[model samples]
Target: MANIIILGAGIGGMSAAYEIRDAIGKEHAITVVGDGPVFNFTPSNPWLAVGWRKPDEIRLNVTEPLESRNIRFVPTRANKVVAEANRLDLVDGSSLNYDYLVITTGPRLAFERVPGSGPEGFTQSVCTGPHAEKAWLSYEEFLKKPGPVVVGALQGASCFGPAYEFAMILDTDLRRRKLRDRVPMTFVTSEPYIGHMGLGGIGDSKGLLESEMRQRHIKWISNARVTSVEQGKINAEQLDEQSAVLKTHELPFSYSMFIPPFAGVDAVQGIEGLTNPGGFILIDEHQCNPTFPNIFAAGVCVAIPPVEVTPVPTGAPKTGLMIESMVTAIANNLRDVLAGKPMKARATWNAMCLADMGDSGFAFIALPQIPPRNVTKAMSGKWVHLAKVAYEKYFLRKMRKGKADPIYETYVMKAFGIDRLKLEENID
Candidate 1:
């Protein structure tokens, strides 16, 4: 029997474990390695930062659920990946060998890319559960003495949805507390426009998001590259379409949060033919490594080029739906490979996002997640916000039960009339 090892027990990792178990059954051994025992629902981070959700509400002890499914759980950090030998070196000095390796280790927040940024620095973050909880504390202190606020994504940042959600959530919270008048908010982003979102804006996303910001009284600066961040001040250079510096702004703020750029985690970096220069695993359409076919990857850890070039660097986002599709494809392909059948499954790479703005929210779907897509739709409403709330509970329940249901297939596809996989050959 083959020993399959899945690394990084986050959304992609967890889903992959369950799906692979269902696909291959108990004949083969499945192991999941993670940095910690708890799994944090990353999408709910923005809500947690604004006091809309508590830490416990979004965090789950994944060990129990995974163990219940007969999947071995290793709660330890990985030191390095020995790609040539198909082995992994653990921080605890123990090594594990596997017949196949699936990498789902999410991005490492590159806060150091900008000096005086991130939780350790002057700015706050919502990238993880602890980070969001800390941000809440900071936000509470800032509430006592409200001042100018700054929120947006930095250069080379991939995920932009959370940044937008937190900005609006903060606005909603302040208005409810009758402190909105005391704070001035500014959004500084690397995107060329308000709603480019790294995929070059879906449907009328530009107009919809811009209109929302205007109505909410939130000012913005696009094509911005944060040069440095001080205790109470931030310096940025606004670039023109030609990549020339249009202007430099010295903005002051009492509270600030910026989505830092992302790179591959330390363990998987610098391996020849294993990862791109940025440290993200390089995968083909089948989600399998080109040089190391036994290795596969999904989620933010996979390298995907920017949809289109911008004056300032920006990376395309791998949304939850897209990641789910990738996980499903990898599991099915592994099953086929083990049976001596040619790999035929391919991820649809569809992008679907629900950006909650506290009182209201925006939703979008991009088929294939790349430019020249077959379909694109974006809309906004209070129902979207409610839908997001329900999704949080639904997804958490699924994780706890170790259910391997394809969320896009069960909900999104029927709702939008889309398919989850684009297979070249038929498979039972």
Candidate 2:
């Protein structure tokens, strides 16, 4: 029996477990090495910050779900990866050997990049369940006295949707509390414009987002780099089109949330031939490292080039749908390898994101995430918000149910002309 080890217990890794189990069947032994015993729906974190979602509501105990499917679960940090040995060393001084390893360890928060950033600093974050819960507490205390609010993605940050969602959601919550009028809101980002969104403007997103921000009375500072944050104030540099700093501003704020940049986790960072200088795993189109055949990767941990250069640095986002597609491809490829068949199947890196903005939201579809898209469209409405919430509920249920690639999910992809595997790009 082949031993397959999947790293990280987050959405990508868990989904990989379910998909791999279904594809390879009982012949292979699957062991999931998760950083923790629970899985939190990360997309719902912004809702948690606004008190729309509770901590318990979005978390799932991954052990039972995984063990029930005959997958071994370990709740420990993966310290280092010895690629040549095909083994992983855990934080608890234990080791696990595997025939194949799937590295899905999501981004390590780069809070140190900017001094006085993150929750421990003057600003806030919703990157994790605990961080979201802390943000909620901070918001509650701020409700008593509202003032200027700053929310946006920092330089080198890839995930811009959550920053947008948090800013708007916080605005909604303040309005519900009748405090929005007292709070001056601003969106600060490294993107050249309001909705570049790290992907060269996805289907008029700039226009739509700018219009929405204007309607909400929210001002924006684009092409901006936050030098640092201090208590009750934020320091930033607005850049010109030529990527030069145009002006420096010291803006005061009663509250703030900034999405930090992401890098590879410690487990695989700095490993020769496995990761790039930024510590992101280097993989071919098939999501496998060229030097190490048994090593595969997906999600934010994988190295993806920025869509386009801008005045300030910004990284591309790897959406949930794209990660799922990668998992499907990896599972099929591994299954074929074990069955003594030539391995093929490559992931279609398309992205469909539901970006909620309080009562209303936006949805965008981008095929081949980088650019020159086969399909690019965007729509916005309250229906989009409802759909996002529904997706969260459906996904959590799927995780708990231990079911992978449900029929309805297939129909959803077919409607978008997205394939689970790259049929044309399959390797021999």
lDDT of each: 0.91, 0.87
Runs of candidate 2 exceeding 4 Å displacement: 406-428
Best by TM-score: 1
TM-scores of the models, in the order given: 0.96, 0.95
Q: After the best TM-score superposition of candidate 2, give how far the Cα of residue 181 lies from its true spot, in angstroms.
A: 0.4
Name the runs in model 1 displaced over 4 angstroms. 410-428
- Looking at candidate 1, the ten consecutive residues that score lowest on lDDT are 419-428
lDDT for each residue of candidate 1 in 145-193, tens digit (9 for 90 to 100)? 9999999999999999999999999999999999999999999999999
Per-residue accuracy of model 2 over 1-428 as CA lDDT, tens digit each: 99999998888898899999999998789999987898998999999998999888999888988888999999999999999999999999999999999999999999999999998898999999999999999988998888899999999999999998888888888889888899999999998998888899888999999999999999999999999899999999999988788999898999999999888898898789999999999998778998898999989999988999888999999887778888888999999888898768888877667788999998877766778876677778997787777778878887788765542253244433445344223211
Candidate 1 vs. true structure, TM-score: 0.96
Q: How far in Å is the alpha carbon of 396 misplaced in model 2?
A: 1.4
* Clashes, model 1: 0
Clashing pairs in 2: none
Give residue 335's error in model 2 in angstroms.
0.8
